[model samples]
Target: MIPPPSARPFLDQAGWAGAEILPLAGDASFRRYFRVVEGDRRAILMDAPPPHEDPRPFISVGEWLCESGFAAPAILARDLTQGLVLLEDFGDARVREHLDAAPAEEMAIYTRAVDLLVDLHEQPAQSGLAPYDRAVYQREAALLTEWFAPAAGLAVDASGYTTAWDKVLPIAEQDVAPVVTVLRDYHAENIMLLPDHARSHGLGLLDFQDALAGHPAYDLVSLLQDARRDVSPAVEQAMLAHYQTRAKASPDFEAAYAVLGAQRNAKIIGIFTRLWKRDGKPRYLDFLPRMWGLLERDLAHPALAPVADWFAENVPASARGQLDAGQSAQ
Candidate 1:
């Protein structure tokens, strides 16, 4: 793969000039990743073009994770003006792919993942991070009405959607859970398994640039109610129990989890729809059914009664399934 011309000077300054650049992956955003190899030396090149993405949050959070004894990729070098950063390579053992290859290891690997969160919550909150407050919550949940509803050919009750969130979102903001650094996208696909590291330090964290100071339950919900993959109900329950036991979570934690789960799933449904409609990426439509399934389960929780009622009244059962790829909101 050819390195972007802007990357040449950055790599040279980082002493990685002439390294072979191989495309690694790209996510739901404008950012792209490439694995840089120069003989025995290796690192990751994060190309987050400006006006669309920034690398500072990523660098800040990564450095904090390393200092806190976690496994976030280290930032080796940076050129913020061009939105390029050199990060320590965490290798290719993603937890999602790992579990796919060895289904029997699901319980064990997930146990470790839960333990990692338990340990992370023990640290003091990282100062200067954004607070995942009510406004952000309401705005995110509105993605469903703003994008998905139109695409599904249903004109949703947008105001009622906000009102429902206004009622139930406070349950998540309750003092029942500790406020900690919430890795907003903590899920199987973003976690790496480092074979050389001990079990406690085995999992490598990624995509945490959007870290926020929020209730500890938010990240846990993100992990259990994953949008990309179906984490079995049995496994989800077990992990939730495991997290509660280890973290000594409050009795109200489950309520918070359900609320956040519904909120996040709504946001994701909107985001995936936006990605397809606005960004021209139809592959994300494939995950809509799974997202809807997870959202429905969360809505069943008593904590989500307000939001559930809104969805029931607005988004009928028929409109809550797979979206038509041919439909466009543009």
Candidate 2:
């Protein structure tokens, strides 16, 4: 779609002369972005669905991050009435796309990436971002039953799964860690590797409009338990240890890792299923089996034993067969 006439009002209010629009990616939700070239300068044009997406938080987060000396898009102007935002264009080369050819070398690069996550979370968030409380946790965890239960074609023992989830859910709430700004989608796909820098860290940030005050472990899980590609056992282990040590997690590290991994991977399974069935993108279905494997491994850890045995008993045998079919075709 062309740059809507509605955006012109914002440009006029800010005294920007022209707008040139080009197609940009549509990764999730109903949000779409355009690369707008006006005069010799460039900026990103955001098209968000109202009521579904209010630009209030996005604008607030951008301002806060900019002041804190983090890398974020510059919000040149905004049209709150039309849900349009003019932002500085980052670039097209995402870290994941670049790593496809040689993933082994990503170890050093990814370590640097984790440091940035540390930076974002180190501060006690003052931005009025909502804490990811019990309600949100339960709602996200329920996606596994909604998406995976039907795909696996299992009606085995509903009570078993429910009871097990009841056991695991409370543990996630045990540590009421102080809230910090979390980049909810801090992974290779959303990050862009700045290869030209004299002292390159990792990817320059992008798509951080939905920042929230949440647990530190949440972003760590998003990075390590990635849904796109297989982060090797050696690499994943190294990262787990690195983060745990740096965070000064002493005796509880092992148990925490297991519980966190299991919880996150379970969420991914449901998310992939929803992406396939409801969102019309079966491509995400390919990631299901790998996430299943990770969950099973975590289940072996004593921290997750209550839920693991229940899953083994309840999740159908047919699940592996169907999920493997999707991956094989891919």
Candidate 3:
């Protein structure tokens, strides 16, 4: 990948005049990542660029994660105005990468990840963080109708879905679980496993800038019901049990997990569809089957009765899966 010229000055200003700048895997966001290597030292250069993206939230959240004793990349240098940041490279040992190499270790890795979440939930509130309340959840869930439904060549009115969620969400909130930082994308792809640190801190967090003070179950669901990869039913159940036992959570926690899981899956279905239709990324569509299955399972929870009924009434089973090839929703 070609390094954009706009990033050169920051490389020089940050004292890496002749480093080997190699492109790193980017996510759904507009931000691009590049690894800067000079001899034995290495760092990540985040090119968030222009008006579409901002790195301040990332920097702030990174600091918060680090301060709270979790593993977030250290911001070594930055130019907020230019949306450029140099971060400490935690190396390539991601949990997904490790699991791919040794599937036998999946249980251990996921258990550690779940344990990390339990600890992360205990953190004190951050200043200026927004609440991931019902309105926000409803708005996010609308992505299904706004992008996915049309992309699938079906006319779906998302208002009913949102309306149903309006009724179902209160059951989740009434449980009295303390709201904590919800790292909106806490799935395997964004998590790294650093062997050098202790088990809890070993899990390196990424893509958490969009975090809000929300239900603790949101992130947990994000991990267990990941859209990109198929986490086995056995593994998902074990991790859930592990978390509940460690957290000493009340019986209502499982209900909240199902509710949040349903909301998150609904939001992802729309997001994956939008990514394909608008961004021209079709691979996201491949995960639709797995995501749909997860969504269906989440909907089975009695807590999701209203939203589940909305889906049943609006999105017919025949219209759910992979759509026509190479057709833009627009």
Clashing pairs in 3: none
Off by over 4 Å in 3: none
lDDT of each: 0.90, 0.71, 0.85
Better of 1 and 3 by lDDT: 1
RMSD for each model, in Å, please? 1.3, 3.6, 1.4
lDDT of 2 by residue, 1-330 (tens): 566667667666766656656878776577778887778877788887687778767778877876765666778888787888888777777778877877766788678777766666666784678776666665666678877777666665656665776786656556544466877777878777665532325457776677767667777777777777677788778887787666655465556556766777887788888877777787777677788877878888877878888877777545643453353221
**Of the candidates numbered 1 and 3, which has the greater TM-score value?**
1
Model 3 C-alpha lDDT per residue in residues 1-330, reported as the tens digit of each score = 567786788889889988989999888879999999999999999988879899999999989888878889999899888888999998888777778889998888898889999998877656779999887988888888888777766776666767788888886788777878988889888888887768455788888889898878888899999888789999999999998888787789898999889888888888888888888888888888888899999999988888888888888887777766568544
lDDT string for model 1 (1-330, tens) is 455689978998999989888998789888999999999998999999998999999999989988888888888999999999999999988999999999999889889989999999998779998899999998898898998988888987799889989999888897577789999999999999996666345999999999999999889889988888789999999999999999998888888899999999999999999998898888899999999999999999998998899888998998887877776536
As for candidate 2, its clashing pairs are 192-203
The lDDT leader among the candidates is 1
